[model samples]
Target: MDMVQSNQLEIRHISPEVRKLIKMYADVNNCTQSEMLERMILEWDSQQSQSERPPGDEDE
Candidate 1:
């Protein structure tokens, strides 16, 4: 269990409502709060890069 292999992070606070929602969803899916957040960030990282845009971008 080395520190380098761990998924460490720092997150800012959110409203109570959002916190409750996150907890509820995590409970239903049987995952920790941090785990759910990590999954979301990974999914975002999987998106296409800026240079790989589709056609019809010459006007910009």
Candidate 2:
């Protein structure tokens, strides 16, 4: 897990579509906006990590 200490997520830079999706998902999950975004970012990171691994190189 990452050790990010910052509490700021500048929403102004996010595309309108993504911003709306975030809001909708956050409301559905009953969590704070930042919390939802953090989960999303973490999920993306995990997916990327898995895809970037070389075949047959699953050592952790």
Candidate 3:
């Protein structure tokens, strides 16, 4: 795999409780910690993008 195709993502400043939650969810979901974080970030981005669109902006 090319390095450019898979970039690193550094997440900082999270509380210990959040860190433990991530680990627990990752284990329950059968994915790595990084994968769980990616899922969370992507879901948040999708929701924000939908909310930011103008009224009646439904996709065809």
Candidate 4:
């Protein structure tokens, strides 16, 4: 399967500790910082979608 191309994302005002944690996580996971962030975003989106669904509507 072909991977989709990602556009650039620029964020500012993050604390140094958070930046260090992200870097550490990326290192442990063997992925770039951008990839780690993308994964985190996708997971967060999935969680949000699941929570937004009505109860007992799991089949949808």
lDDT of each: 0.62, 0.77, 0.73, 0.69
Total backbone clashes of candidate 4, pairs 3 or more residues apart or in separate chains: 0
lDDT of 3 by residue, 1-60 (tens): 432223224434566798789889989999877777778877889999989999876865
Clashing pairs in 3: none
For residues 1-60, what per-residue lDDT tens digits would candidate 1 score against the true structure? 432224334334556786677678779889876676566566667664544777788678
Candidate 1 Cα misplacement greater than 4 A, ranges: 1-12, 47-52, 56-60
Better of 1 and 2 by lDDT: 2
Worst 10 residues of 2 by lDDT: 1-10
* Residue 3 in model 3: lDDT: 29
Q: Write down the RMSD of all candidates, one decimal each.
A: 6.0, 3.3, 3.7, 3.8
Which TM-score value belongs to model 2? Answer: 0.76
For model 2, how does the per-residue alpha-carbon lDDT over 1-60 read when each residue is reduced to its tens digit? 332324233665788998889889999999866778888889999999989989988665
TM for every model, in the order presented, reads: 0.52, 0.76, 0.74, 0.74
Cα displacement (angstroms), candidate 3, residue 9, comes to 5.6
Structure candidate 4, residue pairs in collision: none
What lDDT does model 2 reach? 0.77
Residue-pair clashes per prediction, in order, are 0, 0, 0, 0
Cα-based lDDT at residue 60, candidate 1: 81
